[model samples]
Target: MAIGGNPVFRGKNFRSAVATAPPVPQAPYGQNPYGQYGQPAGQSGYGQNPYGQNPYGQPSAQPQGQQMTPEQLDQMYKAPSAGPVETGRMTYDDVIMKTLACLGLVVLGAGVTLFVSPAASLGLMVLGAIGGLILALVNSFKREPSPALILAYAALEGLFLGGLTRIIDAFAPGAGFQAVLGTVVVAGVTLALYKSGKVRATPGLAKFFLIAIVGYLAFSLVNLGLVLFGVVDSPWGMRGIEIMGIPLGVIVGLFAVVLAAIALIFDFNSIEEGVRAGAPRRFAWTAAFGLTVTLVWLYTEILRLIAIFNSND
Candidate 1:
């Protein structure tokens, strides 16, 4: 099975929890495992009477002391297999619920920003951006998922996103809504493709994604430095420069959107693997956090892309 590219899924517990079934015991070749449907081994049974009673299911008259009747055994065989809840394993529903809870907190935090003054909002946004990064790193490296920390990260991210949207939308009206719509569309399409088996997280693709993400991060840090030092007058720094009549930000923003989309795919793959492998139910929070991170990345990239395009006009 493909271990996903998401960092959270690489924990030791996640890896160790997915164990293969043990091999079944085999009887000696060319010997009858069952004989005459319940006759004693020394009489008509072909198999030796080492264990006394037959371990394999042999249809026989129900003895008085037997716990299960033949009809009950038939019902047991016909019953459905245990679900994730019954088996105490992670499931898609668990991921969905946890994801929703995290996102709800994010929305609540964002909504709080609306009532605050611009100055206060800006300060809160900075606090959220710094705090969120810390929590995200802490959660990513932890051996087990921490729901409180994960939700805290989400809430902080919401504040940052809310302030960012307010600032950008002030200049480019309706850009925030457009970015949200674009993110939803992109995510929805990627999920559809994944469900159809047309898209997958392969090892080769994961390697490429890792390299690309590293390069993108390097470029972003360089750009941030340039902007902070006033080496570039434009708000986007080097990204505002034109290349062949197109703003660099537009190009880079699109590339970033693609990367975020791919990250979402990796998140989906990881969650599926965790659930299928019967990971602990609490790990659902980890999956939720991974997904929220990807979605936030996707939303930010889309927002930036829209802002760049609007600025060019």
Candidate 2:
């Protein structure tokens, strides 16, 4: 899994960190693999003898200890091995818990916005948009994952989302709920497909994603400029422009939704790769952050798509 789709996953040496567990040296006949003469683990240490003589050439006494039976040795050898959790590596559970924590903070922050006045909500939205972007960039470029930064980004994004939802819903009743439902359905399907191995992040698809995302961003920037300069009177700026009686925003928004779905697939791939590669447990925060970012973007696109589609009616 080459980390290329999600920029946040980029530069993180996941594959390079794939730690292969060294094969355990088999114990002789009645001896234990852990240690000898009832010595604790690591007592012999690597390349050092626990009995007779030490690696330092010191004459150490070999204690005469009772040895284990064949049954005991067989049972010990048959025991299940340590997993990611025991090895202090990333796991699906780690990612799920951390992602939930980040999302909980987002919900908490959004709930706070709901209690504020409309004026305050607008202010919070602006604050969140700017502050979240700064934190996102900072966190993405960091060599290691920072839980604090990722959580903060989620909270700020929540503020923005809450305000945006309120504004959109006010204009188009039930649009918010519909958009949320749409996002959930799309995300659920994407995840299921990815888990089933039907959807994978390929280099070719990633390249196409990159190009499409860049094009979308460029168009969005141009549209924002037009709207700001009063060159486009429609509420959606260039997006509101109609072609054959159909709004351009409707078509573009759908394309953006597809892009967001592909991004989610990439995010899932990143998480799966990280866990398989035995990444550090803390990198679960990275996985959580990437998922949150993609999900947030997915929700926003769905919301806009709904809003644009409603405008056509």
Candidate 3:
């Protein structure tokens, strides 16, 4: 019942139910005919009455009206049925719908920032980046998923992405579009591989992913520090350093892209497990949130990589 690898899915909310036999109901005192409370053997007050009438003084066992016909019973049986939510189970449709909702909000937020003035968009982007990061961390560590917070994170990330795209595209026109196309391609390919069983979130691969993520985070933090301290004149800090006549950013970006793809695999695996385990329908939001985080990361990395290539040209 344990969910591992994905921080967003590591809570009891996603655990599977344990099956056990139902306890047998015991009879009340003096109700048992077999000598309970001095009751006589083979003597009982109960009797089978089809009309639900008491054997004690009361109305006759037969009802006044005639019973419904088989046609009526058939009509009742043909009525529209309740859905999965009504039955209290998570379903693929639920996950897909919620995921689409989150993505839609992201697109809406991005569209707003995309058309705004540069100065205003920059300010919003800064606010969005900081806010998104906080919310993302909050949602990840939360025991239960919050729909409001997850949507908020998506909107903030969109704002950040839109502004970043605007700024980067100014320096290198069409780079943003290329990045979008690249993100789509990567996601599609990753999904294909996952569905085809060519890629999987095996334990060893998951461990490797964790190590790589930690190293990448450390490097990114150090690079950010160098850039802020004016130790690296390049906008990308050490990533702008050339190796074999190619910017180091390309290498790192490609590596990061692979990691992001693998992260998608993990997300897919978690979702599949959740569905198979009959996790609560509410956890569909968690699955959506996880996919959003990985996708945003994937898009940003592709955007940066494309931007660097354009800058070099």
Candidate 4:
């Protein structure tokens, strides 16, 4: 007797048969309902979407530079899809570590310059400026950060800064230390202001800062030309010229300290973005490089400021 129609034997036999027979198919394990295949799952379908859609269920992308949804365009234009956005791994400790490394190089180069020839130091300085500039441009444009290049830039800038410090120190023994202290104070205060939102990097401020920087650059070029042509006998050429008994260098240097402080704010902003965007660990070096550049600029200006003040006094 069959299980449906019979009694004792029927139930037992039917149960055994049902148990022995292959199990009726289940939705293929983890198979997508919209998938193309009726095939039992655990198999790839046309377009390879398991659940009748892409892995992430995103529709295939259109051509590049074409119109896209706001979200899509943002994804395309923003930093590459490396990982989740991050924030605040860049602490004062990180900055200090990097700054210490840069300063070590500064010390090394300065030691050499002090014991060796100024010409040797000057030659190295020119080399450093050139090398640092090239690497800076290269790193800025790269899709990924390069630690080697970044560290190289640091070393090069250190050589240049150290050599220049020695030259100026010949005239002013404690000026290097003074400039260093001044740079630290300026950077510290600027960072505090930026972090506290006391000194915001508003768009208007950025625009003004850019204009000032460009003007400073133009003035520097003119002054350099004047010095090279023997038109100016002063140490800083036209930059050292006096207006109302005040060296023009003093005014320019003040503006530069301010500019460099603003630049530090920009560096902070960039590092904030990089960390927030989950940029790679190596990018820490990029942050370090930028900080180094700003500090160097700050120190140079501070040194000049002191010199002008002393000369005037």
Candidate 5:
């Protein structure tokens, strides 16, 4: 994620949340840093040949002279062969690979829910939520990452997503497919816009995001209280209430998309940082895990929005 402010916005990887700048490559193994190449035993500099050829300069010797001295030739041969060039740490390619892995887990989990019985599906969902929560907390707090826990989270999340989608699809034809498509379209558009520099979560915007998330959470808590106290009777609880001709769900759904998309930016930022920091190759799974969480949130929000829109139609 991009750093929002010096550290606050950027600290959480606000999508600018955690990506670091480029990384330095580690030196390769077994190569003699002290001796290899044509120079003197302990010679530190690739100093000029008695004739003043440049040291760090690697251009071929000028062919102006008909013959070369043996000393010059040996020095040229001794200079260490240029080490391999290092590309900046992580890249877009890694993101693609990790994204695919995340999607695969999602599919596997979904399968478990769709074909299994209701009792089984319910049990899977419970397990998925609890396991996913535990993994997320562990990864967020641990000094080092645990690959197994991360993967487990993905698998459990898949079950949760699949079961939730199944429940929605039952009441609304093609709801699951629609939500998936909606999620893809939103993700594609967001990525394009971010790459093009058209959409940015600037410092000011991030402050607003924080404020909005807090407000939304407060509203949700209050709404839940109302439902429990018999103050609201709608299926969506407060979300099913209409405000001046507009359903509350639509209003909240739109807001949810913004929040979720920002979360995606945070996910993207983390992936970018992993690559730049040359974070352990295994951390790539953490990148995938973050993305899966955001995408699931985005998909569920879109599904809710569609359902709300259809209510009036």
Candidate 6:
């Protein structure tokens, strides 16, 4: 596991299973053909030849009527099909299904908030934001993931997002739709870049990302404080300020979008490592959670950026 990067992926679950598991010793060539307890060849507990004789008093090896062809011999040695816990480990199907489940719940919760009255929506959004924060923290620190908790987090986030989008849409009609499209574009581009090997979560880059996230969080907290204290009158607080005739948010938003995209790379790396390490199927929920967090952040940043631009115009 890569430490100090994203809280959702900072643990042993991301480590290689081969690295952690005890190694199996290989049998020496031409010795112990049965490969059990290093027993000598042609020996059994009952003094019978284990390889050539059956326990039912039947001769296991008889004179071959016809020699096997090369293709037949190759077929006989083919590997067995993989089970859920096999060396092939987690497949793309597992991650995709789990992620879709989480996203579906998010859409369900959002629907509830979107149709509700304004006052009720505001209350739900507040509750959802606080609940989502707590669940996100709990899920991040958990050693093993709980599907229920992860689903709950997604629902709460959906509620918060729904209300926020409604509020933003009231001011700027169709802004929410635009934001969704923008999120899709950004995520698609990031994923394509990742698959193309143009971006990766190298150690040096990961460390830099952690540092940048800390700085960004600190800035956000300060900006929120200023807004709450009435020090900044604009909707976006400090981000609404202009530098050289350009809104600060345009600059800050682009930086935040890039950071969110980098975070996606980290998520992808963690998922790839987890699958390669033969992590349990349940851990797919963790992968989904990490991706959801990144996607939500990306969408909100894009939504606010667009809103700021619309307001300025």
Evaluate model 4: give its TM-score. 0.67
Model 2 clashes, total count? 0
Per-structure clash totals for the candidates? 0, 0, 0, 4, 23, 0
Q: What is the lDDT of residue 211 in candidate 1?
A: 95
What are the Cα lDDT values of the candidates?
A: 0.81, 0.81, 0.79, 0.64, 0.67, 0.78
Instruction: Write down the TM-score of every candidate.
Output: 0.84, 0.85, 0.78, 0.67, 0.73, 0.81
Worst window of 10 by summed lDDT in candidate 3: 16-25
Predicted candidate 4 versus true structure: per-residue lDDT over 1-313, tens digit per residue: 1111111111222233323433323345654343433322465432333344445657645443333355653453443322232432334456567757866775675566667687888998888889878876776556555667767777787777778887777877788889888988998898889799887656677678778888999998998999999998886798777899778888888888888887777766655554444444444555666677677778878987887777666
Model 1 weakest lDDT span, ten residues long: 30-39
Q: Can you give the lDDT of residue 293 in candidate 4? A: 65
For the record, the alpha-carbon RMSD of candidate 6 to the native fold, in angstroms, is 6.1
lDDT of 5 by residue, 1-313 (tens): 3443112123233233124433453435844343444344565334324444435655536543334556875666556544212332345665578768777887799888988988788888888778777776665555444667766777888888788777777768788888888899888888888778777756676687778888987988998898888887775778887899899889999999978887666555556556655554545555666677678778878987887677656
lDDT of 2 by residue, 202-249 (tens): 999999999999999999999999999999899799999899998999
Report lDDT (Cα) of residue 133, candidate 1: 94
lDDT of 4 at 5: 10
Q: Which stretches of candidate 5 lie over 4 Å from their true place?
A: 4-44, 47-89, 311-313
Which residue ranges in model 4 land beyond 4 Å of their true spot? 1-99
lDDT of 6: 0.78
